[model samples]
Target chain A: MKIHNFNAGPSVLPKEVVKKSAQSIINFNGSGLSLLEISHRSIDFLEIIEKATFLIKRIMNLNDDYAILFLQGGATLQFSMVPYNLMNQEASYLDTGFWAHNAIKEAKKFGKVKVLFSGKNKNYTYISTNYHIPCDMDYFHCTSNNTIVGTQMKIFPRTSIPIVCDMSSDIFSRKLDFCQFGLIYASAQKNVSSAGMTIVIVKKNILGTIRKNIPSYMDYKIHIQNNSILNTPNVFSIYTSMLTLKWIENQGGLSFLEKNNQKKAKLLYDEIDQNNLFENKIHQENRSNMNVTFFLKEKNLEKEFNKMWKKENIVGLDGHRYLGGYRASIYNALPLESVQFLIEIMKEFERKFS
Target chain B: MKIHNFNAGPSVLPKEVVKKSAQSIINFNGSGLSLLEISHRSIDFLEIIEKATFLIKRIMNLNDDYAILFLQGGATLQFSMVPYNLMNQEASYLDTGFWAHNAIKEAKKFGKVKVLFSGKNKNYTYISTNYHIPCDMDYFHCTSNNTIVGTQMKIFPRTSIPIVCDMSSDIFSRKLDFCQFGLIYASAQKNVSSAGMTIVIVKKNILGTIRKNIPSYMDYKIHIQNNSILNTPNVFSIYTSMLTLKWIENQGGLSFLEKNNQKKAKLLYDEIDQNNLFENKIHQENRSNMNVTFFLKEKNLEKEFNKMWKKENIVGLDGHRYLGGYRASIYNALPLESVQFLIEIMKEFERKFS
Candidate 1:
C-alpha cells in the first residue's frame, strides 16, 4: 500500500534522506560500522556533528555570531533550559498553543514570565497579537508554529528583547532571519529528520548571564566550550539530520522548501474554503502553512472521514486528542504529491457528502 | 577499508539492530511512513513506546513494582533528577570515577551529599570497598561501570541505605537484580542504541518524597504517572533501542550477551597480559569487561602505536583526552571477530615492538 503520512511530528521525511539514513546505520560512510555504535568523540563522528552544524548555518544563512548545537532532550527540555540560561530576572511570552504554554510554565520556575499575549480566549484557535513587549524582560518567547491548533505567527512581532522561538514544527519550512533572534531551537523529528536530536542556535554573546549554577549538560556555555560533545550524542540521529539537510540543499535550500510548503498548504486550504462540506476554523491570516486543520460541515462525520482517509492509506490526519478534527502537517520533507493526493481524497469526500 | 570500532559510546551496535532501525526510519513496520515523520502520540508510536518498555522488563526479568521509563537529557540530567526526587535531607555517594564525581556535584546542589568513599586518592584507579555508608542518608549512589578508568565494582557494597546506580556503560550486558536498587538509569547510547534517550527504572513508592517542587520534565512521579510521555519523547532513539532489545532477545537474551562479553573481554585482556609490549593499568580484579584500558610498555611508542592501529582501520582506540593511552571498549554489540582481529593486530604490534 502506498501510504501518505500526515503525522504532525516524527512526521514525514524525504525519501532520499530515509534511504541514505538506513544505509548509514548499517555502514556509516563506508566505515563498515553501524552509525549507532561509533563514539561521538571519534573523528568520523565529529565530522558528522560538524557537517550537521555547518549545514544548518549554510542553509539558514546564519552568521558566525550564531553557534549551532545539537543537544538531546527535546524542545520540551529547551522550555526549561531557555529560562535557566537566558531568563535571569523576567521574560515575556506569547501563549500561542500547547508548546508555548509549556514554555511559559517552565519559564515561571526561573522568574516572572509576563504573558504579553495569549490565544486562550479563542480556545487557542488563533495567534494573539495584541501584546506589549516589555523592554525590561530578558527575552520574548513564542512558538512560531502551533502543531495542534494549526496556527502560526506569520510575521514575528517587533521586540527589542532577544527573541527566543520554539520552532519545533515549522523550522526549515521557510527562510528564517537568524540575525533577528538571539536563539532558535527545533526538535529534529519535525522538519529536520528524527526525534533524538534538538538543534539549538544561540548567539555567542548570550552566555554567562544566568546567575544560577546550571547543570553542565543544560548549560549552553559548557556545551559551546566542549563543542556540543559534552557527552555522547545521538550519533545516528545527528547523521540522519545531516542527510536531511543535504537533501534540503539538493532541493534548492530554504527558498525552494518555502515555495513547496506554501503550495501544499494553499491547495488544502483552498479546497476547504471552496468546498461547502468542509471548513477550516483558524483565520486564514493566522493559518499555519505547515499544519492545515479542518472539519466536515457535519461534525459527527469525522469518524467516517478518518476511516475513508485511512483506507486510502492516508495516515496521521486525526487532530490532536485535545482538539478533535483533522490536521495535515506539511513539513519540508512532505512531498507536494502527498498533499495533492490528500486534496483529491478531500474532493472525492466532498462530492460524495454534498 | 574494514574498520574495527572500539568506541566507549555512541558505541558499537549490532549490525542487525542498525539495519532494522534505519529501515524503520524510512517506512516503519510496513506503514509506508518514516518513523522520523510520525507523531509520538500516534497509536503507532505509542506501540513502539509500550513494546520498548515491555521488552526491557521481560528481558531484565523486572518485577511489576518497578516502572521502566524512556526519558530524555541523558544520565547527566538524571544526576540532578535523582537527587531532586530521592534526597529529602541528605544522600550518600561512592565516588568511583568521573561519572560518580558528576553525580555528587549535582546532588550537592539539591542537599548535603556525604561522600562514603572515593577513589580520587589513587586518581580513580580502583573502586573503593572500605566505606561507611551512612544510615542517616536518604540513599546511597554509585556508578556500576566506569568507562574512562576501565574499572568495575566486582560486588555492590552492602548498605542499609537505598541504592541508586548509574549503569550507563554496562546495562543489558548482564542480568541484574532490580529489587536491590531504588533506581537504575542507563543513558541508551552505550549498550542500547543512541544517546538521546535515558532508560530509567525507578521504584514506584519512591515518588513524592522530595520536598522541592520539581519541574514536570524533571519529576519522576509525573513521568511515571504519564507513562514517560509527559511530553514528546526521543521517539527515534527509543524505537531504535527497542529494535536493539529485540535483537538481544533473538541472540538468546542477557545470558548470551554476558557469555559473549566475558569471552571477548578475556581474549583482549589475555593478549595484553601475555604480551610484554602492552600493559593494562587497572588491578585485574577491578577490570571492566566493557572498557579495557591499556598502554604501551615503552612510553615513546604510544603515538606510533596509535597511528599504526588507525592505519589498520582500528579507530577510537585512543584513550579519553583526560586519560592519555588506549581504551578498547568491548560493548555488547561488538562482534567477537572484531575483538579477535584486534588481538591479532596487538600480537603483530607486540612482535614488532618487542
Candidate 2:
C-alpha cells in the first residue's frame, strides 16, 4: 500500500533526497565509510559543509554578507537565542499562534518584549491586523507561518527595526527576502530534510551585539568564527539537508516549489469549501498554502473518519491534539496526486454520510 | 579501494549499522515516512525512544536506580550544564587535557572548581597522579579519555563524593562500573553513532540536590521530569544510536566489544612500539586504547609518510592541529583487519624511509 504522509513539521521529504541520503550513510562517495562515522572536521565532511552552505546561498539568493550555520537544539532553542543575542533592550514580537506565544515567553526572560499585536482574541484563528513596531526595540520578531492554526503571514509587515524570524515551519516553501532580516533560523524538518539540524542564516554585521555573557554554542559570533565546527555538528542530518537542497534545486528552485505548493493547497481547499460536509476554519484570505485544516459537518464523525483514513494508510491526518479535527499538511514533496486522492477520499465519505 | 578511517570522534561505524539506519530514514518500520522526518511525539518514534533507553540499560548492565537521557548541544554544552546543575558550592576537577580544562572553565563560571591535580606540568602528556579530592567539594569531575593528547585514565578514582565523567571517546569501548559513577556522559560521535546526541546516565537520587535556577534546557531535573523530551529531540541521531546499540548487542554485548577493541589497539600499538620509524609520545601505562598518537622519527619524513598513507587510502591520520604528528583512532567499528593493513603500510614506509 502506497501511504500518503501529511505529517506537520518533521513532515514529508522528496524520495530522491531520502534515497541519496541513505546511500551516503552506507558508503559516502565510495570512501567505504558511513557518513555517520566521518569526522565533521575531515576534508570529506568539510566538503559536505561547503557544498551544503553553497547550495543554501544559491537557493535562497543569499550573499557573502550572510553566514549559514547548522546548529543543534531546535527552533525552540533559537526562540531564546534570538532574544538572548539580539534583544539587549527590547524586541517587538507579533503573537500569531502557539509558536509565537512561546517565542514571546522566551524573549521576556532576556529583556522587555513589546507585544506589537496578537491574534489570541480570535483563539489564534487569524493573523493580527494592527501593528506597532517599537522604535527602541533591538529587533522585531515574527514566525513566518503558524503551523498549528493553518495561517501564514502572506506579506511581512514593514519595519525599520532589525528583523529576526523563526521560520521553523515555512523556511524553504517560498522564496524569502534574505537582505531584510538580520537573522533567520529554521529547524530543518518541514520543507527541509529532517529533525536535528537548525539552519541559522545571520548577517555578518550583526554578530556581536548581545550584551550578556553568551555561551559559545549560543553565540552567533563564535559560530561564524569557528565556521560552525565549534563542536561536532549533527552531521547526518546536515548531509541529508544538503541532498534535499539539491532536490529542491532540481525541481526548479523556490519559484517552482511555490507553484507546486499552491496547487496542492488549492486542490484540498477547494474540496473542503465545495463540500457541505466539510468546513475549513481559517479565513480564506490568510489560509496556509502548506497546511489545510478542515472538519467534518458533525464532530461525532471525526473519530470514525480518522480511523478510516488510518486504515487506508492516509497517515498524519488527525489534527494536532490541541486543534482536534483533521489537517493535511501538503508541503513540498507531497505530490499533486496524493492531494487529489485525499480529495477523492473526502468525496467518497461525503457520499456515504451526507 | 577501501579506505581505513582513523578520524578521531566521528571515526568509523559498522557497515550493518549504517545500512539499517539508512533503511529506517527512508521508511521506518513500514510507517511510510522517513525516520528523518517524523514527530518525536509520534507513537512510532516514542517506541524508538523507549527501546533506545531500554537497550542502553541492557548493554551497560545498569540497574533501575539510574536514569538515561539523550540530550542535544554536544559535550561542550554539557561542560557548562554539569556544573550549572550540580555545582552549587565547590567542585573538584582533575585537569588532564583540553576537554577537562574546558569543563573546568565552564565550572568556574558557576562556582569554585578545586583543581585536585593536573598533568599540565607535563603539557597534559599523561594522566594526573598524586590526586587529592576535597571532601567539601560537591562532586569530583574527570574526563575518562583525552582525544587530543591520546591518554586515558586506566581506572576511575575511588571517591566518597559523587563522580562525574566525560566518557566521550571511550564510552561503550570497554566495561563500565555504572554503579561507581554518579553520572556518565558521552557525546555520541566517538564510539556510538554520529554527533548531535549526548547520552547521560545519571543516578536517580542525585538530581534534586542542586539549588540553582538553571535554564530549562540546562537543568537535569527538567529533562528527567520530561523524560528527555523537554522539547523535540534530535530524533534521527537517537534512532541511529539505537541501531548502533543493537549492533553492539548483536556482537556479544560489551564484553565482546572490549576484547575486540583491545585486540585492535594492541595491533597498532605493537607496530608503533616495535618500529624505529614511529614513536608514541604518551606514557605507556596511561596510553589510550582508542586514539594512538605517534610521530615519525624524522620530522621532514612526516609529510612524506602522511602522503604515503593517503595513497593507501588511510584518511584522517593527521592529528589535532594543536598536537601535531599522526593519530590512529581505532574505535570499535574499526576492524582489526584495518589495523593490520595500517601496520603493513607502516612497515613499507620503514623499509623505504627508515
| Candidate 2: share of reference interface contacts reproduced | 0.64
Please list the C-alpha lDDT of all candidates, in the order they appear.
0.85, 0.85
For model 2, what is the error of residue A228's alpha carbon versus the real structure, in angstroms, after optimal superposition? 0.8
- Predicted candidate 2 versus true structure: per-residue lDDT over A71-105, tens digit per residue: 98788778877876787788889998998998888
lDDT of 1 by residue, B1-354 (tens): 567888888887777777778778667788777677777887887898899989988998887889999997788889998987888999999899998999999889888989988898897888768787868889999999999999987788777777999999999998767678889999988899777789999888877767776767888988998998887788878888889989999999999998999999999999999999889988888899999999887899877777777888887888888888899999998889889999988888888878
Query: Can you give the DockQ of every candidate in the order shown?
Result: 0.69, 0.64
Chain B TM-score for candidate 2 = 0.98
Please state the CAPRI-style docking class of candidate 2: medium
Clashing pairs in 2: none
- Per-residue CA lDDT of model 2 for B1-354, tens digit only, reads 588889897878777877888888777887777787677888888888899999999998998899999998899888887887888889999999988998888788788989988898897888766787867789999999899989988878787888999999999988878789999999998888778889999998877887665566777887988888877788888888888899999999889998998888888888999998899988888899899999887898977897888888888888898989899998889888889999999999998988
